[model samples]
Target: RVDFTKIVEEQKSLREDFNKLREDFNKMLLEISELKKGYGRLERRIESTFNAMISGLTDLSKYAGLTLEDFTRKILENYLKGMGVLPSDRSLRSETIDSEQIDIFCEDPAIVGEVTAYAESTKEAEKLLKKASVVRQKLGKEPKKYLLVMTTNKQVYKDIQKISEENEIELIVGRVV
Candidate 1:
């Protein structure tokens, strides 16, 4: 005789097993969705942090530049005073004339100069020469001296030095930063 009870019991067990597997798969999907959301949040946080760091760095760079300009101006003033080019009361300063900004400028005994934290190429020297030319054109008189001061320089210092000499731009370098 055929055993109908056994077949029915086996079908019930198979149905239960299928239900359990489906439940487990749904739980795994939920976990994967939560992980994806977490990953998105983490990405946003990292991007925000990176942007903040870049902004802070930019501000710091500007502050450092202004500080260096002040330091260069003081040194140039003292040196020129010692050399008898600048008067005791007069001071070197930054000026903008006809939209051209001069990093270092003096009225009496005309002088034009630029200050940089670091210079790696001769183009820097050439740029200062061009600025001097613009200042001369705007003022309708040639400056007595054109100066290029750098806190540090790379291997191209020799080429820059040559350009400075040929163009009569006094190059002054302090200890490397």
Candidate 2:
């Protein structure tokens, strides 16, 4: 009761449809593989960029004659100027008051500051605070206290920040531009 020619034609059409779908599926798989390879390449590039940046920062820190204090002061000087807080008279004294030296003294603003190359420990932060306290005592005035640190460790930085806040000290963190 079935027509033989019609049945044969239907079988041929079905085979053509299957072939097209299989071809499309293979193309999709190839595209996905290419995308995966591209993603891998992108991830490697990002990691390489980060490593290069860290190395560059390390090299910057090791450069001679540009101590952490010097670097922070250089930046702070510009910042003060921008804030219109320029010192009418800047004094740099090497004299030690109880083994602590005031790194910078601004006459007009009566600002005293301590600078450190690296703040890697709470001990270092305490040392800076002690220096500020000593300067205040020697100056016999409650001069605006400043702590400038080039911090390499996150935990130390946090500790320093907390100490600075408690002591009402202005903390300036130096970093690579």
Candidate 3:
């Protein structure tokens, strides 16, 4: 009463089903791999586009004959003037003394500042502090105000802001460039 043929046929069917499942799993793995590759490509493309845009904007700024530092200096001067911290007639300008360059300096009101397109680290804040110290040492007096002016708010990190606050450095962001 044993049906060997039927048992063999059942075994063959099970093997076929197992093979089909394995093929399906392999296909799914390939699809997942392809999706990952596609995502990587898209991420790279977006980064490239962003860099290109920034480069274009920099070129345009150059053509306009105004560097980011110059633009930031004008904005800071206007702001200080409005606040009555700086005189209406006194304008900010760069000066180099004792081989140290001050990006924005005013003698009478004793304002010392540095300008940058973006501030992304505490190092920038520390650099301004060091410059301020040098100016104080050279001039034999502390400046009335220390400033760090940024043209773009795009990359002003929290650590930079905190350091500026703790060190009593006024961090001002004019506008996005």
Give per-residue CA lDDT, model 1, range 52-159, as digits (tens): 543344346566765757656666687689989899999999998767778899877678887766676676677677878887886778885544444344566677
Per-residue lDDT tens digits for candidate 3, residues 1-177, read 269988999999999999999999999999999999999999768645644554455446677799866755665677679889999989989998678788989877777887666655566677788888877887787875454433435455556657777878876543334
Misplaced by over 4 Å in model 2 are 1-65, 88-95, 175-177
Winner of 1 and 2 under lDDT = 1
Worst lDDT run of 10 residues, candidate 3, spans: 145-154
Local accuracy by lDDT, each model: 0.71, 0.65, 0.71
TM-score of 2: 0.53
* Residues 1-177 of candidate 2: C-alpha lDDT, one tens digit per residue: 368888888999999999999999999999999999999999768645543543344347567556545545555666576667775345333346686666765644557677765666666557666766676676677767777655447677677778878988876554422
What is the lDDT for 166 in model 2? 90
